[model samples]
Target: MRICIVAQTFAPQEEGGAEIVARMCARELARHHEVFVLSLGMSGDRLAPTGEATGEDGTRVVRVNWHNSYLPGHKKPLVGRIEKARWHLKASVGAVSAKEIREIFAREQVDLVYAHNSARMQPALFEASRQLNIPLCVHLHDYALLCPKSSMFSAGGNCDTPCLKCRVLTSRLKSDGEGMTAIAVSEALKQTYLRAGVLTKADWHVLRNENLREDKLHRPFVGRDSARSDIFTFGYLGALSEEKGIEDLIRAFVDMPNRRSAKLIIAGRGREDYVRHLQSIADGAPVTFMGFTPPEEVYGVADAVILPSRWREPQSLILIEAAAYGVPIIATNLGGTPEIVEDMKTGWCYDPSVAGSLAGVMEKALKIGHGNWWAERDKLFPGIRGFKGTAEASRYYERLNALLVEAQRPDHLHLQAL
Candidate 1:
């Protein structure tokens, strides 16, 4: 089968979590089938540039600019609900954009269309797939279809219930997404969309994302000495955003009495102001902000990986990396985290809501050396097949091919949830 992956961005141009998954997916699937990519370029808000190029992964990628108020990139995201809702409302409708996709589908003779995050390439995307009479598979990476902010988090807190603005903005999106096949990274994400009355006629399956660390096999196990409790190092290695709980992580690290014996290493870059704000709060504390550091280098010296995300991560790559590298995880008990992290057994979990909850866990990890919690790595992550990540990769394609065959039947639609 020939496949065309439709995403907002692709690798070699962008290296976010979603792009990495799309790039790896194209390569992995190419081993069995021909693969092509339809992605957006790094242009400004203008909807120009229609050309084809080869991605760094050596996959053929067709890059096109978006037809939106502004393309989402390194810049600050749209602020204010009213302004954000307006952008989504306008970006969703583009008859010309739909025509462009249909033309690409016909030219490529694409057998199936798999969509990752269609930030400004929606409604038209669904229409194109329907017109081509091909299977449409939507990968649920975030809450973009349910909420305009994508994270379902705004105004310094979480949105448990949809506000009036969200209802108005997502009504058309929910209608457009009703009957397409979907592959959610976590069961929590599937249920979230289901609870919102979206994707009712569509088929749903969960496939956890595989580890994307380049040094997955190269990095030595972090905590080999479980009993040695010397000067500790805690690492936070993702975007430095507010919803990511970067501020909260710094506060907990600073307030803890055990902080004197430990240091915090923050890697990854964000908006300049936000990164500066985080650095300001972490002033005088034993914190080092290594901007844009790779995952392997961060995990190299760190004793434990910290994922203090306040927003519910559908499936955090950081959490998955900690497990794969034989490093103990210290994360919040939210979203897909608990599914992998067992309290006091695998690693430590903290409540992000309650005051002092995160600090308490910080002290716990400090008291008990990192290697102590994970004495036997194999017993802890028994599902791990090897350092090369064969388990999750094989399961992804295995389930995908089986689902494609199953979708051929008339009455029943089924797929296994890994």
Candidate 2:
């Protein structure tokens, strides 16, 4: 069976969550079947040209030069109102895009299409899959099906429901989700889509995200000893966007009277303006901006890793890394954070909506100190360690294989298996 993973990007090019998961699935599926990736390239003109390239490690990547308003670069490329609207409209229904996908599918003779974070190609891909009668599987990494921003978040906080603009933009997405296989990375994400009435007629499954299964990736997580230093460094790993609550973390830490003893380390890249704004608002606080360093390095020195996301983030890979490194976790009790972090047991979860909530949690964490988070931390969160070998990826391959094997059988409805 030949499987094509359709995504916005692939490695060894970019390493976002979606790209990482897509590559992982490709690796696992390659063991049993032929696997490759199909992605949109930033190169080439707007004529939607296509090219093929093989990575040094022998990963096959097929890139289509399809631009939607603006090309997404190292940082999210900014788009204006008219162009943004044009892009969204095209995403909703692009006959040309559908034709292109159908031709690609025909040429490749792919048995299945696994799509992740390919928003710009949506609805068109759905039509293409239907026209070719090819099985399509969507791995949800965000609320792309419901919100045009793909982040059901705003300047305020996590949205209770999609805005009117989002409702209009994604009106047909739910119905387009029909006849496809849906993989929600978390139960929360599954429910979020269900509430939005998406994937009602699709084969739905929840596959919680997991870290890479490798020993080198799971190095001993050692919390700093209290005797070692008085300076408590709080590390914020991942995108440095405000919706991630980077500003809130800076504000909270800066306002604290005992701020002198604590330092804030933000490790990740963001838009230049946003990064400059965050730096400006830090107001001379003890915040170090380590641009796009390796996650392992950040997990090593940080006393406690904070996930101050202001949105209903599906999950945080940072949480997994922090746990693997024995660093304490502090995150807003929004979305799937609570599922990973036990309030008083493993890590701290707070409500960022309430004033001084994150600050209070930070104070408590600083007081508690990061000494033996647990005698055996792996037992504290098996989800972090359990899936740490080929276990997680193999599980994905098994389920997908089952789907491809018995998709026409009536018993295939029971695909909700773990």
User: What are the RMSDs of all candidates, in order?
Assistant: 3.6, 3.6
C-alpha lDDT score of every prediction, in listed order:
0.71, 0.71
TM-score of each: 0.87, 0.87
Q: Model 1, 1-418: lDDT tens per residue?
A: 8788877765554466776777777777787778888876545323324578775668888866566655554443658978865666776444137788888889999888888887457677777888878777788888888787788888887777667877777665664344457888888888888888788668788877763534344545532334233567888899888888989999999999978889999998888888888888988999999998877676676777789898888878776666556566788887777766762244668888899998888887677655554465446544332433333543656666565545433443565555
Per-residue lDDT of 323 in model 2: 60
